[model samples]
Target: MGLAVSGGPDSLALLLLAHAAMPGNIAVLSIDHGLRLEANNEVALVEGICLQLGVPFTGVRVDVGPGNVQAKARDARYAALARWAQEDGVGAIATAHHADDQAETLLMRLARGSGMAGLAGVRSWSSLPNSDIPLIRPLLWARKGELEALVGDAGILAVNDPSNSNRAFDRVRVRDHLAKHDWLDAEALASSAGHLAEGWRALEWYAELDWAEMVAPDPDAAVQPALQYCVNVPRTIQIETVCRIIAELGGRVTRSEAGRAADRLWRGNNASIGGVLAMAGVEKVAKVGVEMRVWRFSPEPPRNAH
Candidate 1:
């Protein structure tokens, strides 16, 4: 396993705790996003800690774009860390994402009306996509203050990322909100995100099964590369099924548009998703009818909105 150390108390403590638990089994890695002025010095501090601990260490300085800097830096950081683990033949990557981080992410997703996917929060363990590597988080039980205390007790000074304090960021805003309110209260925030995860899995099973029954292959479905599916598509289930199809291909659809589509299906009116699709042999069937089939396609097109 490899540990992703960012010189922050959370990750640094993770590195130390992991090593103390499994000596000689974990390697420490830090990615310098090069965003803040103190970033280089922070990398140096990480190196110093790794040296004193006799742990193998490496660093990467990334020039993430100014606009969307956080997103870009996060992407680049993960890419670099994953590449490092792969080169070192590490089987998994573990970090210090705790229960608080999970709560914050869930709240932010809730504000955006994020559905099941967002409500589920981060996974405790999962395999990297298209790779043999697994990602793990062991500090899910530790609070941020506890991690900080552990780091201080170890005589390691942590570099505070100012982004954590910035109110402009959604995470910071949500964190502040969670701090002010008692998240344990039922109405305070959805306490069921954990249970929502279970429901999400069950719903996913039903959605996939029902989608297969209601939808069919339509290569020439839409401009966005969706598939076509035939369905009896009861009036009550039309809107939900359309939303499901879009989501199945990782598309974000709004409730208003879903409602319009549903109303069309129930009223037996025409509905179009702005794509001229092809059927068994007939072409340009954007609107599904009684004998008409719904159009969908594979997600291969380049669209910015998605």
Candidate 2:
């Protein structure tokens, strides 16, 4: 098993527990974002802990370019972990995202008006964008305080990340808001996330059936294989089908992006999303009292040379 450790209380607790549960079979992986002055020291501390525990340790330095720092940092962390997993032949990577994190994620996505997939929030297991290795969150049922208590009980001195309290981040804001609302149970919110995950899975199930029944590679296109889908179904089915097609092409399109693209196609307008072009046929057909929309998706052609 591969454990992602940051020397923080939650992650250190995970490290201790995982090492105890899977002794002699666990590897610890840590990523230094290069943004914090103490990041290198943190990685060193985690490495020393792993060394003391007799577990193999790998430390990676990641560059988080200008953008949403937290989001970009997360992307970089997953990319580094994926590379490490490939090199080590590890099947999965584990993180210590606990119940409090799950609640924060659900609230954040809810505030953003996210759909079921987004509201699912910090799944226990998911694949990173453009990666096949599974990312596992084993401590989703535990709270951050509980994990910190465990670290204290084990006599482990964990590093505190200052950015976690910085109000500039939306997650931090949500965490603070949740903290103020003492009556709101983080565990209940996390349970709602699990329920939403089930709903998302059901949507994917229907989308798969729709894909098998209506979607295919466009054989008539001059360029390489493009996607073609029979879009005579309901709007929800069309949107979900488009998402699936984009996912298949290694393009990650958000729900709103897919919905807008599908809407444009339904309106007989050509749309492009994530380098995937959707063209709607003007000549429509009516079958069984419903108007049929046939849309074809292909890679956007390169611009003409001057």
TM-scores, one per candidate: 0.72, 0.89
In candidate 1, residue 289 scores what lDDT? 38
**Model 1 lDDT tens row, 1-306:** 788888999999898898899888878888888778888888889899988888889888877866776788877777787788889888789878877787787877878887666688766777654466788888766678898999999987898898999998988888887778763432223335567777767766665665777676555445544666554544335545677666666665665576565565445454544232222222334454335544443554454885
On TM-score, the candidate that comes out on top is 2
Tens-digit lDDT track for model 2 on 1-306? 899999999999999989889898889999899999999999999999998999999999999989889889988998898899999998788999999999999999899988777898988998866788988999999989999999999888999999989999998889999999988789999999999998888877887888997787888875555888877677777788998887776677977899999888888899989877778984343333445667888777777999
How many clashes in candidate 2? 0
Give the per-residue Cα lDDT of candidate 2 at 284: 45
**Superposition TM-score, candidate 2 onto the true structure:** 0.89
